[model samples]
Target chain A: MLDFSLNKIFVEGNTDQKMIATILEIHYNISFPYNGLALEDCIINCNGWQGLFKQVALKEIYRIESSGKNLIIFDADNTSNLGGYTKRKKEIEVGFAELIKATKKNINYSIYLLPNDSDNGDLESFYMSCIKPDKRFFIECWNNLYGCLQSKNEARYELKIPKSAGMVYSYVDLFENYRTGFYQNKKTKRDYSDDGLWEYNFEENNHLKSLCKFLEDNLNLKSN
Target chain B: MPDQSEFITHFEVSNFKKFDHLVVNDIGQFNLITGDNNVGKTSLLEALSLNLKSNNDLVFKFHSLLCDQHIHHHAENKYSKNPIIPKFNYFNLLKNKEELPLTLVFNSQKVILTDIDYFRLKEEDKDLFVSTPYFMDGIEYKYWIRIDKSNVKPEIQFMYEDDYYREDRKFESKLYKPIVKFRNFYERDLNKFIKELSQIELLNLTAFDYEEIVSIIKIVIIPDIIAINIQKINNDSDEMIFIATKSSKGLFVNVTRFGDGVQKIIRYLIEVYYAKKNGFNYFLIDEIDTGIHFSRLKIFWKEFLMLATKLNIQIFATTHSQECIEAYAQALEELGMEEKGRLIEMEEHNGKVYASTLSYENIKAGLISNTNLRGA
Candidate 1:
């Protein structure tokens, strides 16, 4: 059986790539090689959905699927704030129908939506699902603080969630958000040391457990 | 010359050079042979050339196979150097078994070469010999076997069979013309076959080929060169030279004066032009991108692929450069000839040479990922 680390994770951009790598390493203790993943090994940073689709149109997906399992994780940016989950899910399904059809039916591959399969939001929302229930008060305080800051800010664009879900992740158990800046660069910096190894159980965390299951089942990964 | 393209669609070589046996089938119009050093890449080209054409061309390639210019000199004879030469038996796959004949199969035609004792040089009425200097003990005289442009004959053993004109009932036997070749610098008298082609009216180039060469040269070799002129050298022998017209300088310069890179570019271009014009079916080029720059390789391949396809020329070229392979793949993709271009990789396994054709997917992926296909 192939190692879990060999299973390729095709994601939107550098931020998702780093977040996924961090998640796998910190939580699952799986390490990736220097070069981005291919059949031989390395993470494939598709840059974005358009770039990822181009690779698919070029028949690269068939090549990947032939050699090993491919885990395609894209941002389901259809958050409840913008539109209802039901409407957004339909739009995503329709938009990606061609891709889903092109993929070989027998291949061991899966496409997972963020937060929940049918739910809106993205990797950020999914991280929010991993938050401890005890940190509910802190989440409320952070949302209020973000809302106040958003009103005062001159920047025109709306941040889907007022506060970064990654930033909120730092306050919870088993999560350490070391990432900072607009695009993960060191310019706008935040450094937080892990208090200790959180007493987190793999089976207890449903969101993370599902991701591990997908990796295990699709990749035929022999758990270490 | 035959009307239809006599380009070799397939060939099998055995007991020739390093390759004990190699059979390449489903060959494309353009075949690129590549591998590590001493992998029989050049020998494959030689095998193809010999398979497709006359014996005279094979003699020239055999001499310059290694391109080593080691001519032993003596204190007595100052003019020509004594070079150690090998006979036909030296080509046997198993060196100890000299009786085994080197076999070359082209399409359906098979040509078997035997002992060099059958061949002898004739200069006018006198018999030429390769004279060797006396070491300390004794003197030995030999036939002066010049690699190219030699009047060597096979002691008139039997009637010659003309493979091309075999169908024609008028002529009792068919006469064979040499296949086109653009060899590296080591091969002496590069114009021997080209000069012969020029002598034959039907096989000679048309004005259109000259125009095409001019146009191709503008993109491939020297941008400054406007035209090419085949001028007769004012020497005792009938020797022709190529003069490149410098457009900006408004003057013509001998092609020999150009650097190896420019000469290498022009060499293949000339072969391509001749093949296009005279309907020469096959061309064998060794180290096609020897002196050319890495960046210019793509430009060279683009022009080569387009011209070779347009002229229906079957090209078998060998290269040891990674850039050349990538450039070829890129050119094929750009020209929409990815299916037509074939990269034959040669490797030695268990004392025998093995050849495998790289698939389109492999070639494309290798190039995209910067994978080394040369297998060095």
Candidate 2:
């Protein structure tokens, strides 16, 4: 059973859980299971934004309150119908405040919206930003294809792929050694972090820096 | 809002088994309790049964039921040969073996139980004790055991309101009898089966009641079950329940030979029908989905809710199955009787038990989002 009474991280999906676990293991020396793919002991995948709030409403926040440190990570998901970063952060604040009041317990928790705390995007956007500078042309190529498809009729472009996911997967596919078949079927987009495909330079990338600092401040980890 | 006619609108338990202090408010007509192991789902039911009425016979019956459960749990292990001997301690009923009284409140009425050392009775009280026999005096007290050198036999004193109803005094209350059923798949005794059959027969169920029960059984369990009948093989033998199925070609199969699911359905429906006929408004079932198949859960819940509504009985049932919980939510929605049901989740935190009453909307949202509502 996953212990909720631990300094915990609640994310939006399995990809976010794995990605955050990978980043923590690489930079913070915090080891997680399954080569950082499975973090069931600590990181919880809430399935979606609504699920995160559902967990809060179910008194999961009270369980985390015992540990005294908690972190929630989700997408800003700025769409035509949905709210952006400010609105998402406000939702988290209101939810936590109401739960804290109802439960009568003060919880030390932080909300970090993806890609950065202020950005109107998702985990994939952060992954796109962390792509190697040399592999930027693959993302441009996918964007060009996406733009052409967008200009055509909706029926002609029936394959409605998400832009950020397409860009990140395209960049990672560049490292695929198809001729030798060495990394042919073994590597998936989920293994990008473990395969050392993405840049994790905290000094250079501000987004990665902000996330690392957020973890440092929130989690009770050994300082390097 | 809870119906004013409900038997118990609010319930609170303190210093009882596994609950330091727990309160469940807004008691609905049909309550499905879900929790992790040892979180006091069954304990809540036991607490409610203890205070369901002011009758001393009911109290003794509850104690015997607990003793039976304890004996059954241990009968398979080291006590298999000595199954008649009880290995459970009634003192363990108190939380942490403290002397604090077990307090239970049903709505505004409070029932407090305190264990008094039998040897501590005064000389004048000793005569009262001799004249006042324990409710189980006819049968051997299964839980009456001497512990340690002082001959410490625990005696229970029930205090309701401000009056103490000692063992000698008979409790007189107009409270309706609450039917309590536990999951006892091992109850294959011929006499007990006959007793249940006799009880159902005494209910004087009309043809319509029998038809409703048989149709529900057919819908939720065996589709071929045409009717249920009680038959005696000969004058020398006792009566037994038999199931007449469409495929049996007029042959009646003894109910004892049927599967556990069939037997459980028969037992449950009979109890509910008997309770309704007897003017009982409360029905408590522990492990309500014990023998029923997972696929039939939704229909069983639908029928259960419909019956409870029609009978105007409040039902408290405990379950550990997530499928059962989901089926209950689906049944409530399908019947549009969401307001009549509540999913109670009992959880223990910091050594104190708490019950969170989830409405239909809350339960639906949790199920849709795949939340761990059963505490798993």
> Docking quality tier of candidate 2?
incorrect
Q: For residues B1-376, could you state the per-residue lDDT of candidate 2 as single tens digits?
A: 1223557878988866677778887678889998888888887887776653332433444445445465212212221211122234354444236445667777886666543343342233322433444443322222222222222553332211112123342222222234445635444543464555464455466778878888888888878988886667777766676788888876888887778777777777877877666556778888888778899999999998888888888899998998999899899999999888888887677776767777776677666545567853
Give me the overall lDDT of model 1: 0.54
Best-fitting candidate, scored by DockQ? 2
Specify the highest-lDDT model's number: 2
Off by over 4 Å in 1: A1-224, B1-9, B53-183, B186-203, B233-240, B244-249, B273-280, B348-352, B359-362
* Shift in Å, residue B82, candidate 1: 18
Per-residue error at B23 for model 1, in Å?
3.6
Query: For candidate 2, what is the lDDT?
Result: 0.65
Tens-digit per-residue lDDT, A186-206, candidate 2: 444356563446677678898
DockQ of all models, two decimals each: 0.06, 0.14
- What tens-digit string does per-residue lDDT give for candidate 1 at A102-148? 44333344566565555566766665555455544555776777777
Q: Could you tell me every candidate's TM-score relative to the true structure?
A: 0.52, 0.74
